[model samples]
Target: MAMGNSVKAPLGHIQFCEENRSACRGRDNSPVVVKLTEARWNELIDLNTRINRQIRPVTDEKLFGKLEYWTYPRGGAGDCEEYVLEKQRALLAAGWPKSALLITVAKDVKNAGHAVLTVRTDQGDMILDNQIEAVLPWYSTPYRYIKRQSTREPAKWTGISDTRVTTVGSVGN
Candidate 1:
């Protein structure tokens, strides 16, 4: 897929860190920091469950040059990234703060990279994954998160792990 084919994610998830320091620091982004009351959180969870159904978990063509739409083996397929992207849009359409949503890249215990959505609440962070929509705790995921960018800030993110996973020659040009 080309640039035009690239789907636009929610505004809160696309922050540029250097340009939006306030948001990157996890401050002052309306969409990223939802002020949802307890009732709203429960409502959001319901909405997420409905949206999660549209996504199917698959592992195909992950290293194909630059992945555009998370594809499956049967020609057209969407992985967790595409699934989370669509889920975020659905919640936004249903009147949820985009800031309360996050897209995270993490490595599972098997070291396979995976993507999932994070929902911030007064209690703690709730995770929405293609594998399930029960909204689990962040630590409940058996994956080690590498980085995450909020929809409120497109370019800025945090929580990158060490580079030892790759060889030094793969680090720079």
Candidate 2:
């Protein structure tokens, strides 16, 4: 997805940054697009599948007694944001460039806010969604892209010029 001007980040993300400082620390002004290899593709697909299958889809309120909370689903359950964080963290731990793994927010087909990991690769932006089993290209999804953690700085956000339009505020990213 093409990025737009910087914008205010979702409230949950701000709080997440406060709690998980390291996740939001660091900055690389230059853009990075990963060279996607066949092996890398398989790794991403398998990782997505495993995480989706492992974590129980529980709301933040149910899991943390809050309206919106962002953290790893280490306790076995979490919502979309947690899944995205987990995916991004996994790739980072595997030595993938942090700039290539973005935390994206968008609205689902129902207009409900949803979060997904958007990986910038040589091919294009690919969506790693908890709701979808297959790893799909960003344009292939039925989401209205809104904003995402900037590739240059994970803590900063930039709008996505998604012609479909939207924001997933209530969904928690």
Candidate 3:
């Protein structure tokens, strides 16, 4: 994805960072793109599939009775944000560089706001979505790319300048 100038992080993500400060602190020297090894590729695919099956897709309003409450799917259910966070956390615990796993916001096929995990590797930028089973290249997905966590600073975000998109602007959840 072509990331534009720095942009404001989604409100949910801002609040999430406030609640989980440690996760937001990324090392300045962490690799922005990962070296995609066969083993690491398998791990990404496996983790995406496992999380898709493990968490029931429930909106934050339904689960937390509040909007934009980013959290883990500890209750076996959560929204898209929860799935992304869980994947990011798991990958980090498995020794994946923090800069390589990013929290991304986008407009799905339906043009609705959605959260996903964007894994940046030497091969390409692949997306792990709760709504999709396959781990796909960011361009392969039908999202109108919005913004994502900066590789240099997880607490900051940058806009996505999607060449294929011009019709969509702004975000809603």
RMSD of each: 10.8, 5.4, 4.6
Model 3 C-alpha lDDT versus the unseen true structure: 0.89
TM-score computed on alpha carbons, candidate 2: 0.92
Alpha carbon lDDT at 111, candidate 1: 81
| Shift in Å, residue 34, candidate 2 | 0.7
lDDT comparing candidate 2 with the true structure: 0.91
Q: Any runs in candidate 1 off by more than 4 Å, and if so which?
A: 1-32, 35-38, 58-77, 150-152, 160-173
- Candidate with top lDDT is 2
- In model 2, what is the error at residue 125, expressed in angstroms? 0.3
| Total clashing pairs for each candidate | 19, 1, 0
Please give each candidate's TM-score.
0.61, 0.92, 0.92
Query: Clashes in candidate 1: how many?
Result: 19
Q: Each prediction's Cα lDDT score?
A: 0.58, 0.91, 0.89
Give a tens-digit lDDT track for model 1, residues 6-84: 2343232442233335423544355545565878778767767766665455443453444333322233345766666
Number of the candidate with higher TM-score, 1 or 2: 2
Higher-scoring candidate on TM-score, 1 or 3: 3
